[model samples]
Target: MSLRSGSFPRTFHASLQLLLTRRFGTFWLASLLSNIGTWAQQVAQPWLMLSLGASPWLLGLDTFALGGPGLLLTLLGGVLADRADRRRLIATLQSIQMLCPLLIVGLLLHGSIQPWIIVALSLVVGVTDALSMPSFQTIVSTLVDRRQLPTGIALNTTQFNLSRILGPSLAGVLMASIGAVGAFAVSAASYLPFIAVALWILPRATVQAVAPAEGGRDGPPLAGARAVLAQPALRGAVLTVLGGSLLCSPLLTFCPVLVKTVFQADVAQFSLTVSAFGAGGLLGGLLLMAVDPARDRRPLASWAASGFAAVVLLSALNPWAWALPLLFVAGGLAMTMANASANAWLQSQAPAAIRGQTVSLFMLAMRGGTALGGLLTGLTVSAWGVREALALNGLLALLALAGVRRGWLAVPRPTLAG
Candidate 1:
């Protein structure tokens, strides 16, 4: 389960060491701040919707708005990432994203915000993210040494999870004190540093040149799907994550509904539950950071997803005062382990020529599945109730686990050229 090489650094601080060795640290810092801002907004945005008396369906629709565009536009985004200057492309898209929260802040301050307006802005941010995320994912490889790639990725996940822990807690306080306007304003400001780093700090050559695609380097956008499908390990990673996102991710997406409706909790308790999940994820990412790069992560991801499913099922059965938050922490850990492993495995196995496109497929699976799952689960919750909806998700995850155990979802031990 651990990387077994004496040549590579085997210490827990391998990822942390990378911070002092190169500019990847710079990008990571900027990205962490931006992500924190985003998470804060996420907390406030949902609470804002509930305050407007929106239904569970609307809550789910909000999540869908935040991720739905990836289903249609992410492939093109991947293509653009490989074909054009990644830095400029990502910065441009991020600029567009920054505007969404800014507009929300304006509406909030003007006292004229509605549920549809918030959802509409989320859709805009989601569209920009779908286009830019492939490039953003691909750019990490360019920021560090290839041998240190796994650690670099782990660090990236760590920062994101860390933000998840911090953002919700911060929002809880901000929402109580200065309200949603303050949270939205902070999200707007966080994007500036990242944009500056992308445009002014990172070298142009690092983000500008990409490996040419096959057949005169002008293959269709769907070419990445073909490339991924051709490899067993790659295919398994994508499918595993797809199933994980589709069945289990909704539990986290709809946590507010679970808290407010089922437990009748207030904002502080809701934020506490979210922070617990983030804490577990932080631990998972840190665990990955210490592992060797050569370890095959396929089985790890599969097992984690299975564990996550079991936790989701347990959440439905437990009505104890302390149970749900603890389960959420476990869910967060398992989910992060599954996702980060699949992501690192895919990035390592995929060829350089189509890395962006391949990553886009990963994004499509992760984000697209979440969007659809949120919508479907929302409707299920409306019809059956939160407990039944979550129980169904857990059962579905176990079914996916059955497929993995039966060799239906295989990941052959192999590596590929970059």
Candidate 2:
């Protein structure tokens, strides 16, 4: 009878069945497919760039292209998300994303693919992602009820992590066989299902029209950002998350290099590293789902952050090829706990009216921190070597742990309604 007890309500089930009976399920499935394709392209594009004689600097540049725009544009996108119909905005952005891969494929097919083109296209994708991501978060409110929100978010992340596993593995095979362009083609086609699902869905049910702001000027654009930052708990969580992301996000980009240079492995080996990280993330998500931290998330987040730091440090010292499985576990747990905690905290604190903008600020911190970390790590690895680069990341994690200990990064207690 209890939703948390793993027993579904008959009414809820019936509602779900009805929702899935038409366009809702189709859209979710299509979104999943599109996401997987996007992940595939993410892995393949970087690999393709490296193959074309890109240096570490260029690799960092590529990461910048992918994340920098989000940092710059997400606030604006968040404003737009609050003002627009989220579903329509997402559909339009996704349609643009569909064209990105097509252009990449065309260039590849014509034998004119280059590192600059890859960088340019990656920037375009990043821009589209920046525009769509806020709407995507806001649209989730329409897909399910308040009680189901946490589960829905968890499932969505689970799907993303699953793609993190499948995409790289599939890309490795496809790259080895039909080449990177073939991988790009698959990513291109992934958008069609999502587009179709969007078309099939009843616009009336899913597209909630946002009312215009009451204030004449809509207040300051930065009002939301400033309000969120003013909350000590929220600010702490955001800071801790930024630190963790700086340390964690680079693993995806730099792991390939670590595999090739440090382990002397091939593309499959690189893909396997990514799979390990994803597997760990998947495990972490399952663990979080099993635990109830509503009473107190601060300690949980602090412990997770501390544990993550220790794990990364240990992984850095790990010798032997067998150390990889451990790295996978570390990667998974670190990402799952840290991200879910921050998201849950933000979601809990944010008012529905500005929820999209709040989430955008959170995302900006995430993507911006990640891009900065990747760039810094690339530079560090070039100068100090992989082990040292990883060690530096571990040090950042330790610094975050200190923040938690000093009460500088406390989680906000949710205000309960009577």
Candidate 3:
């Protein structure tokens, strides 16, 4: 149950090499640039809703629009990833993703920025994102050595968390000074470097060749999904994601509401709070880079999920100065540790023949869980209020994930060797 075990310097050096090397480095550059814009848009999107006097339910619907399509499409996308050229498929998706924000910009400029338009545009982006999700994860594994996956995924999370620090903070400033239109423009422009890399810089050949599946029954998406769900290990990983996406993630979804209603803060304070979560996630990602989740993923994951639930519950109770740090820790435990470890652990147990399908299920589960949970959480907020909703999700996740501690602790873990 150990994919990698090593010292701090070993992990650090691997990270440096992954960033400095050719293909992975290029991927890193494009990801960094694009995520900055994405994060900026993330901030602007909710703010836009509020400016239009949207309700908390509508705000939650925005997330649903963005992630809902993945529930149905990502598994198919995963099957396609296994069958087709992932690089080309991703490049096509990138083109589609690029066009989405440009349309949003036009809406912003023309003063026709209706909520439906926002929701539709977000749906397009989300569809592309969900369809390409497994390819994106698989692409990273191809970039580094197989053994370095733990480090690679951790570093990837670190990059995103770092962008959380930089991008939202920048978006807050830009929104304060220039307005949300500029934020959309920045997001539109951010797609260029990634398109360039996907078009030319990434290797022409598909990264790896897999042997044919043992059974010819793998033809259908349903069949592949069934194979995925039948595996006990994958089931556990999916549950971890469900806990994070459903229980813990509503904290971020409800951030704008918290800032506006509870804290009575403006744009800058909102930005600072966003950055706090990112900063905490960044630290957590770095810590994950050093350790091996394969060693004791079950317990670690259970604890992270439970810890995140507790933190979210606490933050909801006391929206004070300390809430910021609590949210930061929540991001780490809920997001970085939970997701990165799940991805790594799932990949370890997944067979190469159905790797794409497995990762797709993972992607779909994560995204689907988030969308459903966001919708439920939004309704909870609408009916009961944020504190009650937060407490409910927290208590439910805690009871579900950590309640049967001995049972989960006794569950078998994936091996180090893939």
Candidate 4:
């Protein structure tokens, strides 16, 4: 990782070019604002639940409810992305998600926003998000050429990570000043401009379903999954991500539990931990943006998994004073790098025919698997406590990742479609 000798300036220039593209620039700006609002709301959720006296299991269940619908619908979304009008679909989905926050605002103001209500709202957001994300990711291919697609994805990750950088801290400020109601309002307002941008820009990020490998057929969405699994590289990436999600990704789900129970931190102090994690992840995204796609991404991804899992295992040893920094080190840098690398690697390597489905599977590994993991981790936290649950599972996952590290390296890169 010696900075590739002379890669920074080129990467920086490429990223800037992507932002300057008329269609992508509009989408990116809108997405940035919307994502910031989304993250701010996310930061408030667990804290809000904490105030409602949410148990560990209840917290995990809430996350599962939010993510589970996507588990079922995202593959379908991938199908829609390939076969439908992506711009309209995205706009429609965005509009649907936008309502969740606005509706919740009234509930919050009325002091009737219970944990169950939060869970219900999360389901709505998750379903729409599941449907929209595959289309969203594949749109990068259309917005930029093949040469800049990976950079564009990295930039996309940067926007998300940037939300992490700004959203939680903003949530902290709003929560401190105006309470959760204000924080939720900001999130609700974020969607308007994002929808407006899509309606205005109408970017050409959609494509026809052309998976010639399936004999140039137009079958069900499962066909796309089969096509992706047929590739060893893509398969390996998906599996590794599944493990990461099932083991390490649930850290956020339980963050409230950890911060409140172990660290004795309030909402503002808890936001600091989130802010630290975001700062690290933002830096990590920048580093991954500079990674050369010409390199074999598998081996590096394996190394990152090993490192990330190890950190999770160690960080599970909860000494509150140092836990925040530990999380920044582990959750922030290692996990972020691993996640971004996996995404760029997969997107760069996937054939145009199966890109939508391929991206959806990645989404599944992220949201779906993490949802399941979050639930299990919550139950574990309830029974064994956060420290034991995290340590045991983190160790098991680390060992599993260590054993399979070389298998990922063994997966040969498929020939890219020009």
In the predicted model 3, the residue pairs found to clash are none
Task: Give the deviation of candidate 4 from the true structure as CA RMSD.
Answer: 2.0
lDDT of 2 at 25: 57
| lDDT digits (tens) for residues 1-418 of candidate 1 | 5645753355665567787755777888888899889989988888899998998899999889988999999888887776777778878899999998999999888899999998898899889999999989987877766676777888899999999999999999999998999889989999999998888654564433433344114666567667776777677788888888888989887888888888888888888998899998998888888777777787788898888999989987788746888998898889998899889888887767777877888999899989989989999999999889999999988998668645634446645545
lDDT of 2 by residue, 119-226 (tens): 887788789888778767655555656554554555556666777788778888898998888778889999888766655552533322433441112555656666
Worst 10 residues of 3 by lDDT: 209-218
Best by lDDT: 1
Residue-level error in angstroms, candidate 3, position 208:
6.8
Per-candidate TM-score against the hidden true structure: 0.94, 0.87, 0.92, 0.94
After superposing candidate 1 on the true structure, give the runs of residues whose Cα lies further than 4 Å from its correct spot. 3-9, 205-216, 408-411
Q: Of models 1 and 3, which has the larger lDDT? A: 1
> Which tens-of-lDDT digit does each residue in 332-367 have in candidate 4?
777777777787788877767677777888898888
Candidate 3 overall Cα lDDT vs. reference?
Answer: 0.76
As a whole number from 0 to 100, the lDDT of residue 43 in candidate 4 is 91
Candidate 2 Cα deviation (angstroms), residue 352: 0.7
Alpha-carbon shift of residue 153 in model 1 (angstroms): 0.7
Ten contiguous residues minimizing lDDT sum, candidate 1: 207-216
Name the Cα RMSD for model 1: 2.3
